[model samples]
Target: MDAPSNVVRLPTAAPRKPNNHRFKEQRAAGYEAKQASVFRERYINPRVRAVMGDAETIMGIEQTPALLIASALFALADPDTQQKAMEQLAPGAVVGRKAHIQAIATMRRLRATTIGEQYDFYNAIDELEKRRS
Candidate 1:
């Protein structure tokens, strides 16, 4: 079967993954890389930029002097005064019960079939409020 060796031949390698499988793997890797890039661009980059900007702004003179003075005044205050101030700064109790009450009231005023049929359905969460109160 010997002939003139003038034709160029394609190179071959040992069978590892098939060509189609190799391409699929590469395509999947590319997709993951793109997804990571998009997430960073869409979320991480903006948040980092915002934090850096806020930090820079907070470091400026207007904020710096005020914070320093407040800290000094806070540190020098009497213990009871500090305790009262801290209590004042602390968040008060949530008014969720009142919100539910208002919601139930509003629902009662809505145009239901019997003008008050809405009370039964809307009053369910109100029971939770009653138990809590």
Candidate 2:
């Protein structure tokens, strides 16, 4: 039978109920997740209604491409260029070192892409294999 005399057993705790005891920030974020976003209502709707006379109007095919190109240009632009884009709200330099650097980088990337079109990776790999042998 049992020979141990110094061993002590303690009661185990129940599994943690994290959901039952969420932090204030976690609870607030959970509540926010259930709500619809007000982005269009706050920004897009007002401008669209003012210009087009309808907030429900769709950006048609012609406007869609222009919007896409504008987005791409914005993506390529630096912080200064992006700020100048919203010049009415926040005015600053028309161009800066950041803009110049981004422009040069974008042009270099474009040129590299154009050059990469003629590159034959399979042939290059074959040559590498021959060199290794």
Candidate 3:
């Protein structure tokens, strides 16, 4: 009878702890790249410029349909006229009423202007119109 025994030992290194900061940074970079599509340069960035222009003008206010729904009670009138109306409708709410009235007045004034009559709402977004096609 013959007996043979073979033994093999492999050295194993201690398990290394993951670098939390680097892992987080890599994860953040991946998240940012994924979000890059959420903010397309030609779309969102250009639209941001349009939004800024909208914020400056009366037409900008019209785009906020919700505000109109609430404030529809107010009619377009000059400031003095609005003050007189406010004195009757909602007696102590002077400043707030004035703001609503002023918005209405400005909106009406803008409507009366020649530019208002000629405004092509879609043309503002027409980048192609800038070129001779």
Candidate 4:
């Protein structure tokens, strides 16, 4: 019987890190798609459209949820801008009585979630779903 040789081999060079900038960019695109999904699910009905507008217009800055949310995030960092955006949202009502009140709140929460946070969140969600199944 022949004895087997015991040898340890180590790599001369480290493996290159997989560049995920493209993946991150894709995730950002997914975020945009989520915005569309929100509109489709929340503001889709014809009656809602009557108050909101068509899909494109309602999702537009002039009359879209994004504008309201974006404005709120901007306002969070800048009180003056927030006041202006609030005034624009509810010209007749009080300073904080805009239809975007919820949107602004959501934006505030979203500010804490950057692209990496979102990636983690999605992974967590997927794991939970798998466990549930």
Candidate 5:
């Protein structure tokens, strides 16, 4: 049988493996270490100091969540926004309004201190929202 003259053929290449191993190694060496230090310095230490203050009180079980809520609210820039976020996160919690007020006071006290990048704070809140869902 005679073949048609308009026939075309395409060439294929072998699939290449991803070079993700090197990327993981580099990230572990640099990014992870840097992130750990930053997290400890910026988030954990500050929250601990805020909760503990100069005089140490025995940390009760209930105090952990309270401290966390306060810290998250304090991270926000505005009182109304913090209140709204708290309301959204804990619809009927009694502490929502109180946390908002405390957050406002904290914000005022730390007004001169920089809060790092706004995007980072928003991203953290987004992640927390996702976890709640």
Candidate 6:
């Protein structure tokens, strides 16, 4: 075992710990942005444009409502937020009733699983009617 005179042993470096936090956050943010873009392209923009219809109408109407609806749709994609929205809007206040109707319609159109079984469309309509009185 003494025939290794010409061989040199190299020292091994210590294993480096993975710093995944920054990369993970960056990746998550990127993925979220991409998903949001896709959602806008596929659903939000089309609906908003449909409501706008033409240049004159688009210029006449405020963009805030469409933006709010899109934001609500994004938030409603989360189950917890969807539940909170349902609870918050169930009391039939005028504004809440309108939001409830919009949310239900958006959920149905999107085929969102988050609020699939939870929202009652008829009850929402009744609440809206009550609020209108």
Candidate 4, 28-80: lDDT as tens digits:
99888888784654433333233232222223325468766765567466556
Candidate 6 per-residue lDDT over residues 44-128, each given as its tens digit: 2332333322222223334488756875676656767666665665566445455455544443334453352334433344344
lDDT of 2: 0.42
Per-residue lDDT tens digits for candidate 5, residues 1-133, read: 5537886433564355556675778877787678768465444333334433211212112346876676665665476765565456453333545444444434434333445433333344444445458
What is the C-alpha lDDT profile of model 2 across 1-133, one tens digit per residue?
A: 4637886444574444446554878878866864656553233232222333111122122345765585577667776765555453222223444434333333322232333331432233333445458
Better of 4 and 6 by TM-score: 6
TM-score pick, better of 1 and 6: 6
Residue pairs with backbone atoms closer than 3 Å in model 5 (clashes): none
Clashing pairs in 4: none
Q: In model 2, which range of ten residues has the least summed lDDT? A: 52-61
- TM-score per prediction, in order, is 0.23, 0.22, 0.21, 0.22, 0.22, 0.25
- lDDT by residue (34-123, candidate 1, tens digit) is 887846543423333333322332323243576557656766666677666545433431243433333233322332334233343334
lDDT of 4 at 122: 46
**Which stretches of model 1 miss by more than 4 angstroms?**
1-63, 92-133
Summed over model 6, clashes come to 0
| Candidate that would win on lDDT | 6
lDDT of 5 at 53: 22
**Stronger candidate by lDDT (4 vs 6):** 6
What C-alpha lDDT, on a 0 to 100 scale, does residue 43 get in candidate 3?
49
Q: Number of clashes in every candidate structure?
A: 0, 0, 0, 0, 0, 0
Model 5: runs farther than 4 Å from truth? 1-101, 104-115
Candidate 4, lDDT over the whole model: 0.49
On TM-score, the stronger of 1 and 4 is: 1
